[model samples]
Target: MQTITLDALIPREDFNILSSTGSSSNTRNKQTLSIEDLKYDSFFFSALRKPIFQRETNEWDAEKVCSMIESFVNDELVPAIILWRNQGGYIFVIDGAHRLSSLGAWINDDYGDGPISISFYGNYISDEQRKAAEKTRQLVNQKIGSFKEIEAISRNRISTENDLKNDIAKNLGALAIQLQWVDGNAAKAEDSFLKINQSATKISEAELELIKNREHSYAIAARAIVRAGKGYKYWSAYSITEQEHIVELSKKIHQLMFGIGNINMDDINSLPIGGPLNSSLTLDVVTQTVRICNGLDRKTKTNVGDANEVITYLRNTLRILQYINSKEKFSLGVHPFVYFYSGIGKHKIGSYYGFLMFAKELIEKKKIDNFIQVRSRFESVIYQYNFLVQQIIRKDRQSKRAYVSIKDYYVLLMEIILENPTYSNEAIVEEIKKNDKFKYLQTEIVDNETVAVKSNFSRGKKQQIKMETFVESLPRCPICGGYICSNSVSVDHIQRKQDGGTNAVENGQITHLYCNTTYKN
Candidate 1:
């Protein structure tokens, strides 16, 4: 074996006065590369192996990888791959994908267009299928080639790979190979790998996941949650952003439940089965439930085979919180309901759950110390739970509205909370006032001191304003901007119907017929 350039198999410097006395040996026609230095017996798999990215491979992808390698071996060019060394002893693939992929295929026994060697599968063939198999071999002999002839046919390979188990053992005995293999530091290797792959440009989910990592902030823990869930990929695949939301949510859940600054999957796996599946309030409930469980040092317990118990508690909690958020529908910002996701981080479940502790203390008041025990007892866990809570809430809210994208909403909420945690209602009102949607809010009461109009309410008959006049007077729909069909002059509940909304003037809103339909949906 020797390191050499592709231009010349035997580099002039390493060229030797070789003996080619055998009649069958070719002195001038043998394929040899210009080698800088040669060690004829040094060629081995370990010398060519490089650690890149420690990719976690499952059966499905493992199958695909084997197939990919088989395909590569059939072709001539070898594209580079990125490799990295993970905590695991295995070498991570960074680059030279085509080459190493072929290697994997060889190891997997997916060679010569057939899969072999690997175990875990049951019986290789059944008596019932033997006839079909025999027929296939007979056809290969007549149409393609005899198994022996096919085995000996000139292989279309630039790089040859084989093992003792393969039928091509005889061919391996006669082959001579000349090539160069280069390895570099893992980080630099990946950079080079990326440069090589940049040309081919296949965008992969793994890459997208890495992109979301943002230099591996708390995001790494979050990504880990999603990664674990990939084992259950039967669920819809979320976009990179939504995936991050799930991760962030996991982080929040860990934070709040145990006041844990980090997230742990062991805690998350305790949530109910349908918890992650639900896109609605189920996520929020699951998050809180997981937090509560983590708060109890549940992570240390090995008996948590199922999260059903904790999930049920979570549902109860959501049922309670829903009533509260419903009564005081506070819009943290645009898209009203989205406002609450940030609140999870604003205060722990204990803080909000204090309303209960209050009653327990003295029918209406829980002391600050009692609240602290509820909160600070699991301070680290609390952050984890809150992280999960906000994450689910984020995904739910984000899916409904792209108006305020995830990044924008997250940044804005964080900024506002950090800048002024105790922003007065008046201050919130002022900010609310700044929204373009609120500009149309009714001005004020008609003053009793007004010179002419003295009636407290419209009296006697309806003020006979003309249909055209009223039509011209009304504002356009703030939502859809169609003519607020003055014909249907009654106000509409701006919030919505299913939410137990009503058509009272205060609760109602002015909107054109067409716009109302759009808004209703």
Candidate 2:
């Protein structure tokens, strides 16, 4: 689904400060907000806030958001937005956040790249986000026209050349989004929200866990790292020093995992942990990284009473990430394409987590050097037989279980490589088949179903052909002889700089960061 991200449309605020048992004294809260009331500078818009625990407001795609706006402009039967006004005079959305956000986005002309989003994300938006915003803006403008243009036409300040625009403008005055307000305390409001959302859209288990533990260390760290420490500061309550520390750690981890530019089939050499930096995918990646690094489970809710604990968790996660890709002495500088991506350029989360587990085991056993010794041959085998990684992950299905088997597979592969550095692919496969643990690695041959052939290749086939050609032409690191990518490559001096190495072409060679910094030395 082509989902449009309107998460920045409705800002989040902690409603816990409001009295849990108190209700709004004023009974005159409006039951509707007109387009003018939702303008960027309007008091009604400023007072509107999403509850901190609310899931991101990016569920609706471009078509859905535009459809909602079209319905509203036509005075169609749109659902009422549910809200709860606190005693402190702030209105928290109880339900229908997506609906309000869609209208707010259209009025403010900010699908995501607008002023609100820039301010909300601290000017650190991703390319993916920017592209999605542009797409939504174009779709909305093409279909329903901009809100300002429609209003101008409605007021007769501009010529209404377009019939559809004129009709929508004529109905603009009668457009009022009906509002249903919760009349109880914050607790009651929250309960209503959970019930309504659970029944209506059904929040995913992962998202529900995040919402329930929004204040916990893992959740906070995940949110910070996913946005590269730029979006809403869930850790804002912490001391300035601690907040700075959290941001520093979160930024390092984010860069390590997702700093590489967006990955596509054309540029499959370098892949990030969760593919791109989308809100949903990155949340899963960060959440799993935090849990795995800290030895926490899915159900463990470790609350962050202070910023210190959040910083600690972030630092731990950062250490693991650094070890995975940094230039540190023990860092593996593991290439994502070699380990995580399949031969067909698809990212396998099962392979990613499995490699992480394997790395952690190496760290625990102080055997990183053992892996480093055979790193070249190991990476070669992995790159050449990438299909095996795909097959193993495909058979396992469950990511968690697949990761365990993958980790064991890595161990088994390393063992074989250590014993015989020049093992052939067939020899390795035969050996693996002998082991009952990896009996699933048995080769399966299925005859292709006969069908009418077409002149043009299917999309998947074209991608596979392209990937095969690209893989064949990939460059190798001179130091460890492993495949190097634009993101992971580092230039090193062939001759030691201290030994009269000059800035000449002959003095330089391409290598992985770890190899260039530590292995060569």
**Highest lDDT scorer:** 2
Summarize candidate 2's per-residue lDDT along 250-323 as a digit string, tens digits.
88888888764355667765567555665455567677778777768665657655677788888888887777
Per-residue lDDT tens digits for candidate 1, residues 193-296, read 45555565443433433332322322222223322222212112445654444434443343222221122222321222212221222223333333332332
TM-score of 2: 0.90
Point out where model 2 deviates above 4 Å: 19-23, 157-159, 299-305, 326-331, 384-401, 445-454, 493-504
lDDT scores for all predictions? 0.30, 0.78
Alpha-carbon TM-score of each model against the true structure? 0.26, 0.90
Q: Give the C-alpha miss distance for residue 324 in model 2, angstroms.
A: 2.7
Worst ten-residue run, lDDT, model 2? Answer: 15-24
lDDT, model 2, position 439? 79
